[model samples]
Target chain A: MAQRTVLFVLFDQVQSLDVTGPVEVFAGAERHTPGTYRIGTASLDGAPVRTSSGLTVVPDRSLADVPDPDTLVVPGGQGTRSPDPRLTDWLRAHGPHVRRLVSVCTGAALLAGAGLLDGRRATTHWAYCDRLAREYPAVDVDPDPIYVRDGHVATSAGVTSGIDLALALVEEDLGRDTALTIARHLVVFLRRPGNQAQFSAQLAAQTARREPLRELQRWITEHPGADLGVETLAARAGLSPRHFARAFRAETGTTPGRYVDRIRLEHARRLLEDTGDGVEQVSRASGYGTPEGMRRAFVKALGTSPAEYRRRFRPAPAH
Target chain B: MAQRTVLFVLFDQVQSLDVTGPVEVFAGAERHTPGTYRIGTASLDGAPVRTSSGLTVVPDRSLADVPDPDTLVVPGGQGTRSPDPRLTDWLRAHGPHVRRLVSVCTGAALLAGAGLLDGRRATTHWAYCDRLAREYPAVDVDPDPIYVRDGHVATSAGVTSGIDLALALVEEDLGRDTALTIARHLVVFLRRPGNQAQFSAQLAAQTARREPLRELQRWITEHPGADLGVETLAARAGLSPRHFARAFRAETGTTPGRYVDRIRLEHARRLLEDTGDGVEQVSRASGYGTPEGMRRAFVKALGTSPAEYRRRFRPAPAH
Candidate 1:
């Protein structure tokens, strides 16, 4: 019976999908159960703002003209790349006062700038995860899940994941059946759990600058199923293990073990997508000693099991 | 570069997501590969239109003022429930002239009204599939796919399926790698393959108005694996098999066999979602005879396999 008002903060160059995907979801919920949500959109000033996609949106009110709604949604975009300090200040002042605070994509950057996500588990667009972590040391950035809910604050990865998070919020507020009905009408999953690891734009390791290390990189990629311990890799590179480890990290921006893990993960993903091999076979071939090991790695880094990951990422039979 | 112009037709009470989702995808593609597309939105008179969720969108041009774009997109919402005759007339005049024509959600209704979809396989929002078929009997309505592409014309089901369709369109325009990059950035699937059957808003059967048949409905749901032939069910209902079959259709708005199929499918879906049973056991319990039969049903209706459907719809383990 409470918490009915939902407000979306709009801005210049905002990602249109981030704004509309979740807005339509809440609107659909309102249509399904009238009086469930009174939705509105606001911009920093009262003027119309052009979305990143070039669509112009006229807001219901300016942030200064509006009162804090029960739920506040902040959407991200290229605009977040150089956000106006006034906007982040506004978020800082009002974010904690709302019953629920949510961000989509690089909107988390704005939230992080406002310091509202301090000491909270959060996520942003996959490509920006490292930058978000580096820039905001107080926020724990988890890139796995499509969305993360830490107490009253929630942040969704990338753009469309906002729809998933909104559906969850509706499920919490109105109930699961209502959310499911809305999701069915929208033709999206009630949730994508986390995100697919196959689209790991952020995970590709940098090529080593040194020729020997670069050759080592190629060898590691070629033999993902081989023993990739530091000692083995160092011997293969003809360097002492300690020096090889530091040099690899310096050149690749990641440690030898982590680089090997990513190489094995990508190799196995390709096999799953391009081959008909079973999970067990793919695991052994990708250097995962057992299927359980692969499963754990998948769930830890991608919030999905290997089998489910293949099902989602593999092209749908060319139908 | 040969076909870069994409124009979206907008109207009052248009679903903002329908317009924005695809627009964002094309815009993302353009961002990734500059000069890829020149996109615009237009209404009949070039007036600003309010979205179904009350967001105001200012169109870039008027329909009459615009030239025939390479791609034409029509988005649907409450306004399509009683479309302006001029809009349909305009669509009828220009629909065939475009290099590619597309519709999202109930926008297919406008295309059908214009006779543009006549004799072509198309789909719309799931809830309106029956009405679309009944009203435009010439259009081959396939409800199974999230989006159906027939040559240069494409139609999508429901609201968010527009995003999936747009991703497909981008993939067709650019390369798979580019589309995948955009999809990763957006956090949406490159494709949802059609839709999830668990969200079968249109598949739910009408409750029989007759008490005898209503009782039969309950029985069928309670025991999906039971022998549900007309003779067996009729005998239990104290009526002759032939008479009961006729009465069932009149009361339930579907044939006995169809009703039983829905029951078994629903039962199987629930088992897949709620239980830990394997595919083989679930097939038998749902009266599917074999795992292959159940798989066939799932693929035909949901465009997903039983195992994949379970992964998609089940309540994911709490994070």
Candidate 2:
């Protein structure tokens, strides 16, 4: 395969991690498979840019000096909050031409401002998701997955998720074995622990504003093994089941049953990862009456049997 | 409580993440609880140090300008392999006087060379652990844990373990709640992981150089659910039970029974983290006869029941 030129764009106040995590992963891959990646960093002008954490980065080349690179990575930080028009103007003009256009964290904001992500399903740091959606009505901002790849334009969530997205790109280019090797070298999961596909977005999406409902939500999360049927929860909350379900949906954006399912799955997944517990015990603890119930949930939601899921996602003992 | 001042020593060729990961965590904490931690970065002469990744970092002040900091942090990279004598000399003179002394990645090498870790238990990047032990026999290097706390001086493994160690310090100084809040803001785990105490060290420690034995080791790791009795394994290896047991111990340094236990525990933990499988199924799949058997192993090894372990280690549905 021919070498791919990967250029990282540097700006003032960029979060250093948004740059290093991916850079390090790709760099590790390059070390293992030399001539696969030719990585470089550039700024709008050939000057030093200070990271949000107060580290200053001196760029290798000017943005104008390098044109139409295979991959252009834009990292986000405070600088993206109020960016230079020249930078966005540059992105607006050159983004579509690049083979791969990527953004880390709030760098999505810059891309949206430049119309690169217009009508694209994208994601950013969870904290900034709502703002990105609100500000750029044309951009489909997903606040859930660690990263999103909409065609050739890809975006990732806060800080470390950049590492995840970068690994995905590497895996695409060099296959799973190469990506896995680099991840092991970095001591990070090739895929982070747990099912990112059925990520905890539903439960993290909303919390009831009412104090009693909020307390109930916490209770449900904390005690996944407890009887979480609508009637039992309704009695505890001093409301009729019908009334409780309505209030929960109105306040939290999901029905009580759905929320409970999400929590139980999360609980079971944690047990599998952290403990040497049996599937039956994990199922019971996660409120599944039978092991089969948990298996069905795992298959339906995550598209893998519980055992296979564990095998795939869990760290292969440090060796 | 008086605000503790944390000073990070920066040097040329330092890993940027080694510096930023901890800085971002502390910076997030400061954002939440103002006046709690005053964090700064400095170099021997406050010059702009270029990181191994080629990013330039300008230190906040000169090392001579800051004396007797409450906490001193030395981050590692390629730079630590051949450090300036002035930096090591400074650390040797000033390390003990600080309330807390910390090292990340290969930074421990510098500390060990300076005699700061001469009689203290410590750790560094996993790949470097053996080298660190071989080079500095006086430094009681324990390579198992992600991070080690030897009195007031703490050392951590690799790039990301620094984040884990930093969070531990924040938890010690502030509280679980404060540290947890910062972690959530940064999209990282507060405690990071399931029984980090029962980390997969045994499996990581040795891989038999002999091809057949190495293949057997891989088999044991991959098929934790298999019947792995000495007789069964001996049959698979085409040897008598006694001979197989002896050869396995000699080659792997650990008995087959011990290796199997480690692999089983690791497999069970992965299921708990990634799947919605029930505990009984998880136990059976992990080759434990019953949920009770799995529970016993978990308690003996991780000191937590399966249900409790899942609760403690699982990510709270991400809100």
Candidate 3:
């Protein structure tokens, strides 16, 4: 049998990984299972589309010339931010022909725009779930899935989840060994499963909060470097320290102290990962009074020291 | 400071997610701190490069015309499989000028090909780690990292790891709040720093062994539908059941019965995830005689029932 072809459509400011991550899985699969899949790409017009980063991507086919695609993948970017009626029309027109219609991240918005998700259970990037639900009332949006598959329609959460969706499809088409090989190749578990909640339960607990406390949460987020305290935050929310503490637990699903610790820990992690800052500096910048404090947080939250965490998590610098 | 300019180099067979994932994180930052970043892409020859999925991407500039970028991101693809010497040369010549050099997935191989990984700690797509270590003696390859940053060189493991890397970078360049916003927009945690261990200590023990049982293990992996038992496996290994059980524990860090059950459960999981077979059918395919038995195993190992597991883990069908 001829290899099934998966065609990807790209555009200006499009999220690049939405396409590449899945492409990597498919490309890697050839090593394990010879000649099982073929992948390609295209654009709305024949012109090169600049990525959000100003990288121009030329399409393999124009909208007018796309061949019969076994699977059609559409990735989201700033280009999809404002609904393009023509693009929506094109997707709607092509919706029934493709074996599967897949979108990554906010590409779900584009799918929604096309009316393909109007009456089906679907999900997009989580931040946009409310907007998607608001904009497309006909669609039943699932905010939790990494990717949702309803018959032939599939949509993935955020940028990276596309890889999970793709690997799962590969497993479906091939078999477990082949999929495991690809996962090993990618160095990821075979599939996280869309049903596995996208966000951690703890994170959701923190984010699911009501105001005053919500305002305080925003303040902590906005001022990650500040030495935050319960009293100060409580004052900002116009609640007493004890009342605020109780309210915070009720509203955010965690204590004020733990929430603050989480924010600070997250801040320190960002510095350790992206910057060349020493542990001391990162610690201070994340509201920790000392490197030791930050180290303790790392041990508590991640079960690794800050230095070891940096060694494992930091991206290698170009020589 | 003026907004940092980022140039993503595009090419034929480029992984779509590699380009788009980073693009989304970087672009999403503009929503919180607008006008902080400018991102673009270019091809070596400024011609349209076909992505692995046959999507042709038009680039922003030819290699000759691109601005000296603040950050240079090279994504992995089959194009990097046997890298172009010219491309490697271009990277080597320009690598020094860029503030940071980053690679997603197998794109690290290109950096290694360019000699950028010399004497530096690095990582790539896990599947290619052996080849990377074998081929680049100067590079200290760490396969366990989701992403690694040594000096200004950064490399990520596999597809979605790129998003994690990008988020880290954004947090460094911008701030934690901004990075978190982007992460929230994408609906992913700010960092999943401790997610690198692919197998447990028990699985690692199995991987360390090299004997006739190793081949048997491989065979078991290849044929999950088989019903070979301790007796059958012992006969194949030319041992008595008692001796084989002891040796299996000594060599593989697991009891034979437990190992077989684990393998069976793993196979059953894949079937449940990839196929439409009912729980009973999946159980049978994975050598389990009954659905009830499989459910108990599934729940024990994975914390989800087979039916629920399928609903959650099943791959997106090709639309």
iRMSD, per candidate, in listed order: 2.4, 8.6, 6.6
Cα error, residue B270 of model 3, in Å, equals 9.6
At residue B226, candidate 1 shows an lDDT of: 79
lDDT tens readout by residue for model 2, B130-237: 889999999898765678898989998877778878888887888756665566555565544433334332345667879788898889888888889999999888
A87-151 in candidate 1: lDDT tens per residue?
A: 99999999999999999988999999999999999998888888999999999998777889998
- Mark the regions of model 1 whose C-alpha exceeds 4 Å error after superposition: A193-196, A204-211, A222-227, A250-253, A271-300, A305-311, A315-319, B193-196, B202-211, B222-227, B246-253, B268-300, B305-307, B315-319
Ranking by DockQ: 1, 3, 2
The CA lDDT at A167 in model 3 is: 79
Fnat score for model 3: 0.36
Highest TM-score, which number? Answer: 1
The residue pairs that clash in candidate 1, if any, are: A146-A194, B146-B194
DockQ of each: 0.55, 0.16, 0.19
Residue B110 local lDDT, model 2: 92
**Greater-TM-score candidate between 1 and 2:** 1
Ranking by lDDT: 1, 2, 3
Residue B205 miss distance in model 3 (angstroms):
15
Better of 1 and 3 by DockQ: 1
